[model samples]
Target: MTAPRATKTRTPKIRENLPAPQTAEGLFFHYTPEEAAQWTPFSARTLRDRIAAREIEYVFNGRDNYLTGAQILSLNERYTVKPFSKTHTRVAA
Candidate 1:
């Protein structure tokens, strides 16, 4: 008799229901790399570099690259480091 294989399941990291950016003018569906960079702590060049590294998600509309608010948020979350308490002990691998 053969044993059944085990499968692993993972939940998605990013929330799909996240809304796009809402501006004073109106809700912008997407933001250009330059605009997206302004929203985050990084620069436009950094965003481009990240795109090249496939670290962040973006859209290419033929002429330029654009990013949705959710994607930018995901990028930020991916790099966000959680701080450990001073009393917390490190686990050795």
Candidate 2:
């Protein structure tokens, strides 16, 4: 009689549907003073001063400061200059 052939057992594969990881562009609506300075025309020191003087809104997370998108929008509204009118010219009296 021939020896019985050994059978190999295979484990079933498991698949999971996990959420995609957040990227800097997607997750970072808030920014540090330094980061905000880099993204905008303001200097880091200027941002810090604004935070200190309460001219701008910020979040203090025990260790670091952060600025939100809404704050940035408000700042832009406050500081952004409108374009000069091309139709209106100064007439010498």
Clashing pairs in 2: none
lDDT of 1 by residue, 1-93 (tens): 898887877532333443445443214367766666655779887887988787777887888677877677777788788898688788999
Model 2, range 6-58, lDDT digits (tens) per residue? 79775433223321113434233666666566444588779989888988888
Q: What is the model-wide C-alpha lDDT for candidate 2?
A: 0.64
How does each model score on lDDT?
0.68, 0.64
TM-score of each: 0.55, 0.54
Q: What is the lDDT of residue 44 in candidate 1?
A: 80
Worst 10 residues of 1 by lDDT: 11-20
lDDT of 1: 0.68
